[model samples]
Target: MVTIAKANAELWVFPLSGPTGGSGITAVDVIVVDIEDSDGRAGTGFSYVLGGGGATVAAAARDMLERFVAGQETVPPQALWRRLAGSLNRLGRGYGYLAIAAIDVATWDLHAKRLDMPLYSALGGVARTLPVYGSGGFGPTQDPDAAVARSLEYAGMGCTAVKLRVAGAPADLDRIRAVADALPDGVDIMADANEKCDLARAQWLVNALADVNALWLEEPLPAHDTNGFATLAANSPVPIATGEHHQGVVELVPLMQARAVSVVQPDLAMMGGITESLRVAHVAEHYNLVVSPHFLPALFIHVAGAAPSIRWMEDFPLLEPLFDNPVGMDADGNISPPDTPGHGIQWAHGARQEYRIAE
Candidate 1:
């Protein structure tokens, strides 16, 4: 019997835009990997493309695929992750999450494939599909009416909750009130100031939202404003959420240690990948916190399903048409994880005409 063989990688981009913090996702660039053996079967993995900027750390992935991990015999998933992870550490930059993210996820893709089982089942089977909330609304809404209308639309779609943006605009309080007034009872409201609010103003916004029963106040202060985060978290009437900007585990652990956030909201694609998110989850769990991934909800859902403390997945449904068969959403607003081999991502080849190479 032949042992194992080689691996190959891809730099990809899908044409669509997702908006956040005044920016829209004009593309989805990722580094994908395919690993094969002496007998010829293979498994695939991927990472954000140059931080989803059109290059999936391609040069680095090429280095790893060529220098290591390509022709090795199949090993335990954790061991392979460590080996790929270790390479980045030895380089001393630790800016290799693209390398780390691509390999680690692909390794799991391979493991799930080898067993012909969905990733969640391979890990431990699903605990629950978990509740999901509508993530983005009032994003740079030029018209306050349009913004409030959009927020209500999300709630009307049966989302258990909704997140509205406050651009640090002068009438931010009015916008919050407009949105809260639109949402019905039992449908919770959360607000993101995108760090537009300083500690003092964040406190003011939190207090203003309290009358509306806000579920949480997200990133009211700039991300690095730890004292601001602590000040608000310690005293804000609304729960505080953050972590979409943290670079890696080292940074996140300390934040969790300080009780800096009520909810650990890591973006899977941005937080390096499932590997680092799991690390964040452990820290969040140790501190008795909830892990709610920030975006790219389709992939994040699987990771969320695996964490015992995952409170809810982010399922901003507006982006559904961007994918081939968008994730399943229901009348009650529950989001379900697909029982597929990989993350259930399949690009429609020769179907969509807008496809472009992000790199």
Candidate 2:
């Protein structure tokens, strides 16, 4: 029987070229959790903080390992996930969930490794190939020509779809026009506002993008604005998608039931690991809403294998910089599940030495 022998957490910060979306992409904070069992097996998981608070997340992760996981006998992953959530009921989905995400993911990785099975197959292996979309085109930094070039770059790579960030201004219509006009034939375009718009602004965008033939508009209103999203959905020429920032399935259910969103996007870290992510996907399937998880296609590829409702896997490459063997897409714009056991993430040589904060 494998029991948790040791667990620790550390912080890794990486600087970006420029601002990404509205988050001001100066640097990213990563909380890394390393777990080991009595038998000497190991697992690693991490969460991303767009701007700051890496210390808090890392501390919380360490606390979780010491308080609940260390010395515990390995058990069914779903049971461990529940125990972890119950242990931190008071935190109410704050930084603690981020910690829970990393630990729970590590537990699953350990479990999959113990069984010598690829995580995708362990998750149920519903599909071998998941379609992908190139994600970029930040506004205020990437001008129309630059955005167009980026879109074409993805298109040239055989990507069927590409998503660009909307500036959420009256002039955004012009930017969309310029990019839309330059897109190659048969390539689909999508827009993301990153919750930068109010109801009126979202409506204006919906109306302005009437002729762009965008596949969808993401987070036009804030994630919590279900009423506004419902209102927009009633009038939108394009489908609406949201939920990356939602705390859990509770926040997402209303949006799906109200027909407020056509696509449901959940970040694994924000959604609290594979257990909850699969739960969300099953719920979306019940409601007939498309599930497209936000970021980390490499990890979410396993979820796609298990959840048939996951329509597309996004190729954001947010964490690729840190991995020596990052997942890649095929010439046909599709990605296959990793054949290796566990999540198949190979950290770059000396990554922890280079990025880990010295204690």
Candidate 3:
């Protein structure tokens, strides 16, 4: 049996073009993991922090690798994930999950490469194209006219849907209306509050979004407010979408069970990599809920191939520039997983060298 020979983790930091809406995130910290087996095969995986904490995550990854992964006999990625997570049961789930995420991703990539198949096919999925929504161009403070122009730009690109950030204010309704009025007949609109509202304002915003014929209202309240979500979902006309902030399937199942959320948005790092995120998608399917992952369409398009519940992929291009050949949107505004072995993500020629943080 092949055994893990060595595992290494590195930290890289890249500044965003500007501070993002609501979160005010000005930079992204990437923790990259590379693992090689006794037989000489290698794979790559990564996790990210929105604003800070790269060194902590990288350190955690190193600890986990040295303690659990190195020299261990090869196992299925799912089983390996369970082992690592179970060992950390008492360690609290903050940055540890992000650390596990990078290793889990790398393990999955290695498994796919060993089998001489693309990740989707290795995960028991056929290669298929999935729909994408334009998820940029409008921040919480953006003007309605600019929002309309951005929506039109997405429309020109053949995207059927676009998402804009909302701040749960009275003017949010007018802003949504302006964009809706500008878009063509079939194109849909979605709004993300980014956890900027309390229950009262979230309730108001949901009704307002429904009145404007929006596709959905995302993260209106904080992710932990399950009781509020259940209460609001019971009365809201439009669907509520959340899940990016949640850490694992354990946290998501409660929301799904209560019928609190209609759409589940899993982030790769937040869900601790493809293994748990896939579990979330399958669990969402059982609840008859829709799955639209948070970002990194290049990585998630593979998951979409494996999970029928994933109907939409977000096209917020944050980390795409760091990769040499990320999958691109089709002329029809849909994206598909690459047939190449593994996830097919490679750092650009000098990206690692340029962004690597000195230890």
> Which candidate number has the best lDDT?
3
Q: What overall lDDT goes with each candidate model?
A: 0.68, 0.83, 0.91
Tell me the deviation in Å of residue 72 in model 1: 1.2
Which residue window of length 10 is worst by lDDT in model 2? 136-145
lDDT of 3 at 8: 93
TM-score of 2: 0.96
The candidate, 1 or 3, that scores higher on lDDT is 3
The TM-score that candidate 1 achieves is 0.87
| Per-model TM against the reference | 0.87, 0.96, 0.98
Residue 244 lDDT (model 3): 97
Model 3: lowest-lDDT 10 consecutive positions: 15-24
Q: Which regions of candidate 3 fall more than 4 Å away from where they truly are?
A: none
lDDT for position 33 in model 3 = 96
Q: Which candidate number maximizes TM-score?
A: 3
Pairs that clash in candidate 2: 19-25
- The alpha-carbon lDDT assigned to residue 277 of candidate 1 equals 78
RMSD of each: 3.0, 1.4, 1.0
